[model samples]
Target: MTSTATTVPAAPGAPAATAASAATGASVAPSARPAPVPLADLVDAGLEVPVLGGRTVRHVNLDLAASAPALTAVAAHVGAVLPYYASVHRGTGYASQASTALLEDARVAVAGRVGARLDDLVVFTRNTTDALNLLASAVPGETVVLDIEHHANLLPWQRRGRRVVVAGPTFGATLDALAAELARRPAALLSVTGASNLTGEVLPLAELADLAHAHGARLAVDAAQLLPHRPVDLAASGIDYLAFSGHKAYAPFGAGALVGRADWLDAAPPHLAGGGAVESVTVDAAEWKTGPERHEAGTPNLIGAVALARALAELERIGEDARRAHEDALAARLHDGLAAQPGVRVLRGFDDLEDRLGIATLELERGSVGLVAAALAAEHGISVRAGRFCAHPFFDRLATRANGLRVSLGAGSSADDVDRFLDALAGLIADGPAFAYDRTPAGWCPRTDDRPRPSFA
Candidate 1:
């Protein structure tokens, strides 16, 4: 359940970390090597942040699960489309028509990316939390969810009288527990995450879907973490509802989607009661529209949708195989390196690295998690997430300490990035922080703020 990487190098044949060989004694050609990812073309392509002693370094972002850098292709697409943008749905102008077409096309693209059924409805919301909250409102009866889920999936259901099933020791047992709960009662929904935000543990979504369906419950997947790292097929998995965010999917913030069967969504009231949701608004009566328009009451995030579509397309162009190769290599390196480190604990229930995303959370012995994170940023320019990572219950379950450090990999992350973090952690463990830091009410920060301030002007 716990391991450490003493050195930075990964162990040989780490599960899901090695590329498949052709056959016995077959050699791979040099041309077959995966090309380096081209995600550096991000808007802040060469941006650097200040570290300790007034020095600056190019940020090594290892927080992909939280939010990813916008792809260059996506930024370019947004720039090209911005000039001709106008109001969607009702505008009669050329720009409006083009914008409307773009939004519809984006909806199709997102739906296609997740393998949504032909009859499924894709409703755009603020983010995954908003999308899940919308679904929570639509459920007619009690919902069943696990305590290991992120707050986005948990809190919404709690408001709707959800049954919280504490996860068992093993993943199989957890599924069995869910089955037992569903069998015990008639639940309206079975809410779960495609992957754990805290541990990156990929849940058994297919079997879960089968169980939910058999118990007459609809399965809703919060794919904010899974969609970025792995492919999710709603149709194939038999998931009735799915929600994800554009920020985690490599697009700009402020847009997310809830894709699922139309019946529940249609029967529920409009998510918003503004302009576009209504078909007619008389003095005493108001009728609502159906489909996505019902929830997207005001002007929708056309730019966000277009950006998301472009990011998804870029990922598709690069191909999942290549991305997975890159992630596997980096994750293996990070995982093994951290596991080998003395006094470091890798947070997860699984002993192998096969059933995880490119995410690693660690509980350190030498220093506080917040201090370690700050030291990494201030001293070594490595940016990783620290603290609870928005999943209090799961973090409480995994971490023996109050806080933990999280490093998540993505297509943009390089092996060099992983090595830098490992080296930084080793240094911190050996020498402590180079710069003086103080824990503030907000969080830990460098005590010395003598560096020149960045000017927006």
Candidate 2:
């Protein structure tokens, strides 16, 4: 998916794009609309099409906002560290010391990537969801969340018995709305997502951070979507704390982190208390170790953290500006192409904003979103997400509250992938209403080779 805008005006005297709608309540036929080139087209051209069924089946993976495929450099970095794997900051063995150094190095690497202070501790957990949970356990007092936040960033507060104030889609006026919300409720922390998990529209992080600080509240961002595509300057952005999953960042590891000030994290009990977290345990009396170790208990997923660090380092090496440009260009291409379609309503930057990520979630005419999604995956071999995308509140304001289809891309994507998705989508829309072929498992269709293929035929 790319940012889309139609350059070609209605062919001379054909009809204004809205003229048909004004005359009749129904939209114009999508088939009559011109096709726009998508980013999938560019990406597919460069990638090696895997051979399946005696023919090359080029995969159009548009789910990168959920998780990107690992880079070659990141894989190599992980392979190098595998031989020296050992417990960090615990064992007296040489491997242990080396591992300890590497773990700290990983912290520094992650800190640098996000523009945090070097001394800041990056406590590793299971994934972004886990990282946010860790923060939830650490922070005390009432939490304020936005309507657009993913559940990982919202539900944790509920579990902690903290009062959570859910705000509406501020849209262009998020900061003002947040400031007013904070004034009404004196908050200790504000948990927010850096971008919408579903729409790929960026939240105003810097502005939000500033607003949170003015009201004497600390802000923590779930950068699950931001880390893979944009440069997350935690310090510069004024975000006191940040969390993102390694797997979602293209590491595909169990490791994730809650990185920020040590005071709040240190004052709170260990999220998962055990071995490395304690200095001395005597049933009743226990002394905890200093720094990130106080939180990371058990053996720790050493390999996972190393891989995640490598992934971030690779992103930094490639340069954030360059990568964003590549993805933004592709997204713009797709957005323009799709926006021209009569009934296609893109769930991103429509009226006010111009810039956005490569990811796009949309609704099509005359079809169930689930059916359309399944058809794209099965018939076209193009993977796109459909439904609420873990964002129910965001959908509540959308024209289609039941569900909306998502199309997201990432660093690994090219133009061909975008094109394939658009091409597949065109066919799916033209087919009219989408109906589940049978009572197969959800997200399943008569497929070639995906996890547990179901027969759509």
Candidate 3:
């Protein structure tokens, strides 16, 4: 179903814009608010790429949900931090002290960004998967989860003996199902995604938190998708724990965080047993430190943390209203345009949901999705994600086929970008791919491919 036909709620404090206005490029009650500026400058804003038939076009990236390109400001911050890169924790040298300060500062900044409580411990990790895995290692008891989760959120809990509740037909029904499971038996934590990575439909955090708390269980949100698109306040929403990745948040230097109350983390053994994690060590026994240092064993991704902090600062400066306004318009246009096509079907988890990110996953009724995705990239210079998206079980239930195409946009996207994608897809649907393609082990590739990779590669 298309979102355009529904009366989706506007971002808080922002005027609503109808699907018609979005399709026709009309302003949303121009007098109601000032016109939005570009959300945030991205590192590769106008990079050119070679398309089929030896033609060049400005690359259009509709795969932000996978791994967003770094913000220009974030890249600059990385350059600034690289000069002082050194080992952290207990180092007396000048560079080490500077790097240590930056890492700790980043912890504070990230915690503040998510409205973390004063007693919360911000543990650094490799990515969202790592963060959730760390939490799974520390959780005191059984966990409850929904079937409509990415594997990172699902498998970790399953390994630790979780109660999996299949999602219901609608979001409300799904909430009820979760409540029923929680009431059936007490769980230590109710782990869920803040938004579905496949459908981009946002879940109500406060409501979920309330349900978990009512059943005497804590809540942990996998905010990998939610944090980058919208704001999250753990304190205000009653969220007990939060996990997210820097890669998805415009800083791709292998860093993420798990922020939550310190009791359980301190109670559990150190995530890794090594130098920085221990206070004192004997040959056979060691005393692990508590708090963040307990889990962070060796050298950390100091530059990555610094870059993430800078990227969050940039997003704050751009303001949430402007970001929401820009993405809302683009998403409406995209969903409405695709739904208008004869063979295209936009995937969604809930029919009654209101808010979503600028992410749309679709399947073609008449053609191979893998082939179409390849054509979009080779012929249109458009980058989108195709396949199971690392959620195979969820995909098997939601899709008729084994895979689908996902087109997602973010801060760097523009009206022109959306229009170009719509036009290109329409053309492809009408005339088929311009060049012949063949299935390869990697995926579908042009039969006689001649595109050249950048020299750096």
Candidate 4:
């Protein structure tokens, strides 16, 4: 099945066509234009790993929601930048000046990629958790959030005044519940996830933004799962703030950003009180710098910022339509295949959710999920996630057992990857693992195994 949607225009300052066309004075006709390059071809597509029974096979990464392998383009860009890497903002050397320029360019790219408004500030952060924590500190009034959020979006708000509304039976009812909460008591912000990490269901941001605005609140979205699969236009959608991680976007260099309005951020005290965050300091007092400088203390992740920017650019070049088509086909296959298995039960948050990414979490009727996850890895070279996935409250409410198995795909995933996982799972469910397994300190492992670790490790 194909996932269909209106083609979203490229954000301001983002590439609208292939890099080759941008370089030369040429225009390619729509009919003659080549298909976007396969995402699998742009990453570590040929990775091989050792499995049980003295065999090695191609590694199938089905755990993209946790962390994705760095795209080859991003890695190449990082390699080119490392030689001249230096501390930014104050050094007089050529390398420092160049590094400073690159960092600022990355900031601009991030802002443009999200369609940030003119007054919005793009603050570099450690990851989504750190970005939300920074926003939590700056928010002036009580925040309203749904109970289905990831812990990163939930925990930070809890530290401040927060109102948690239980999601209703259907997506539409959930929106009504949120509207009711905001009407009952005014909130400064309405925080929510763009896509669910476990169920892969997508939330309608434009509608959510309108709901928040009607209730006199601002909307903030956690787009770690959404950005990889879809394009986000904060300005057009009326989102006041956005947060996402590079690691989840196929740029795993330990970087993230918070893009949003600047008033509250400037009013709040600096997130960290250090050198770069201060404008003037004395023995008795210190004055903090406003904007992004107020929060980015000490040295920043220069390489990470550059890598993230490159990844976003590459995604733009690939185009959203191509990415969606590839992922939609794979997701449909995985979901349908899992549903066909008698022992497997697919999880869902709402009955009315129509759009979702390539993620699925399921429970088995008669096996330890941990053992099955381990068996897939040891015997089939397939990697997946098992456990609470860092959203314990939501997991506890939805799952039948302590945890469930999650299979997620991304830009680098192919149809074969999904098929392999489904086949292995079916075999395991029907006849159990081919090898004896035992619960170890780390989780489950083969009773007698001697698979060699990769030489690099």
User: Whole-model lDDT for model 1 versus the true structure?
Assistant: 0.80
User: lDDT per residue, candidate 2, 1-457, as tens digits?
Assistant: 2221111112223245443442333333333223333221221333433332333466677877766666766667788888899877767999999998888888888888888876677888888888888888877787888767787877888876554444444455656677887899788998888877777777778778888889999999999888878878877888989999887777876788878988888888888778888889997988988778888888888888888888888778778677877787677667765765545777753344455677788876555667666666655557777778777765666646477888887777766666666655654554431323432444434333433333562
Residue-level lDDT of model 1, residues 1-457, one tens digit each, is 2222121222233333121221111122222233334333566555798877878888888888888888878888988999988999889999999999999999999899889999999988888999999999899999999988888998988778889998887887887888899888889899998988888888878998999999999999999999877788899999999999989988874788999999989989899889999989998989998888888999999999888877777787777787777777667777777764556788885443257888988887646778878778878778899998888988898789898899998877766677678767765665567667777776777777665667973
Query: How big is the positional error of residue 241 in model 4, measured in Å on the Cα after superposition?
Result: 0.6
lDDT of 2 at 45: 37
TM-score of each: 0.90, 0.84, 0.91, 0.91
Cα error of candidate 2 at position 359, Å: 1.4
Better-scoring candidate (lDDT), 1 or 4:
4
Query: Can you write out model 4's per-residue Cα lDDT over 241-298, one digit (the tens) per residue?
Result: 9999999988999999999999989998788888899989999999899999999998
Candidate 4 matches the true fold with a TM-score of 0.91
Cα displacement (Å) at residue 418, model 2:
0.8
The runs of at least 3 residues in candidate 2 whose Cα sits more than 4 Å from the true structure, single-residue gaps closed, are 1-55, 161-172, 349-351, 399-401, 432-436, 441-444, 447-457
Instruction: Sort all candidates by TM-score, best to worst.
Output: 3, 4, 1, 2
Q: Among these predicted structures, which one has the highest lDDT?
A: 4
